[model samples]
Target: VELILIDESLHLQNGIEAILTMVEENPEILDDYHFVENIRQSIIDAVELELNYLKTKFGGTTIFGVSYGELERYMKYIADRRLIELGFNPQFGIDQNPLKFLQKEDVKKLTNFFEVTPTEYTNF
Candidate 1:
């Protein structure tokens, strides 16, 4: 089964704006690879290209382990969770997603809920 993973850091609006700014200023050679090889941010900046992923290319998809692909990125945000065992700082973008609270075995059970498929929906 094939799976698709979405990286919201670059997939979100904030990351798009950064790329547009670079192209607007250098209208000449985005053709070359050096134009936007660097970026920095405290929280989320969409792609946060500073991070590395050999599997993921310009088109899309990133790996987050075998079962992780089942979880949605923003299904549960920090929203100010008040637990210390999770150890996720409030400032961190993920801020203790439910996955963090789950033990390894518990996470494995998640596979029962998701499987890869060629298409999700035909039309609305």
Candidate 2:
């Protein structure tokens, strides 16, 4: 199983109804940093608990880790050390121009550059 460390900031969108959208879609986005951390911790606990139970039955030897420090804690607690750190290499600037969504794991986020069509008029 792949461990996904979802970045909360990645979800925010800069739009006229940003706050309203946040409230409707994910109220968690408005939560304070500490409160959000608590939620993440609980999620980590649940995954560890499930992994512990599964290990007893099948004894699999692999951990795709997104957080090494936290994963080490659970690994020690459960006494399993077959962790493999998932790598994230985000490319910026011109370095990312060559990459595409169809490409490999290491990605370069491309800046969207497009022309907007001239509108005849603006209406409310």
Candidate 3:
């Protein structure tokens, strides 16, 4: 039940490429693979690193709750500002507003969702 809230500005390609290079050089994996497989593996590794960083280092997942005015601030903080800026107010749906339900009780529910709920696949 882990949550991931990307600020929309995070640089993904560079991190993905870096991780792919590392994984490709490792001698323990299969000796041969296709370009698409490499790219897919790179994306998976990059996502895992990002999630682990948010969880272990920050002690929680990110929840982008910026107000309308503060949206620009987060947009600038991300690596691909141009792309993120183009997608301003990127609401997936009316019900997907995290800030709208940021009441204390709602926050407690969200936080507890991570603690009490078991993910479909738990490493432990």
Candidate 4:
């Protein structure tokens, strides 16, 4: 079974939203200017490497890749909304999501917990 992480999946997006909410609530916890950028670059590098390996092993297969900037924009949108919900203003001026194809119905379907089943467990 293949485990896929979709761009608009609530599990992934909500985690990011929570983190940004935390940061906004307690700005002193993260003082580094490059913190978010570093984390974003690391995720981009890791995903690109994994996707490249998959492309090499499974030749002729089309692979869809999301850029670090695109992912950041989506996460920023979620974060901004979350901040507003928490009675705080949005720090990031991202007015739109980069991945516009992920509609509300798609998110609803993707986030349906009953539709997901764990195939295997791996200790992180």
Give the winner by TM-score: 4
- Candidate order by TM-score, decreasing, is 4, 3, 2, 1
Listed per model in order, the count of residue pairs whose N, CA or C atoms clash below 3 Å is 4, 0, 2, 0
Task: Report the lDDT tens digits of candidate 2 across residue range 56-122.
Answer: 6544444442234333343343221111111112111122212132122223232333555423212
lDDT of 4 by residue, 36-83 (tens): 556555444655565565556546543366554565566567555554
Question: Candidates' lDDT values, in order?
Answer: 0.35, 0.35, 0.38, 0.56
Q: lDDT tens string, model 1, 99-124?
A: 55333322232222256432423232
Model 2 score (lDDT): 0.35
Q: Model 3, residue 6: displacement in angstroms?
A: 14
Candidate with the greatest lDDT versus the true structure: 4
**Model 3: lDDT to the true structure:** 0.38
Of the two candidates 2 and 4, the one with more favorable lDDT, higher being better, is 4
Q: What is the Å distance of residue 17 in model 3 from its true position?
A: 14
Which parts of model 2 have CA positions greater than 4 angstroms off? Answer: 1-31, 59-124
Alpha-carbon lDDT of model 4: 0.56
Which stretches in model 4 have alpha-carbon errors above 4 Å? 1-8, 61-106, 109-124
Clashing residue pairs, candidate 3? 9-78, 9-79
Which stretches of model 1 miss by more than 4 angstroms? 1-11, 36-67, 72-124
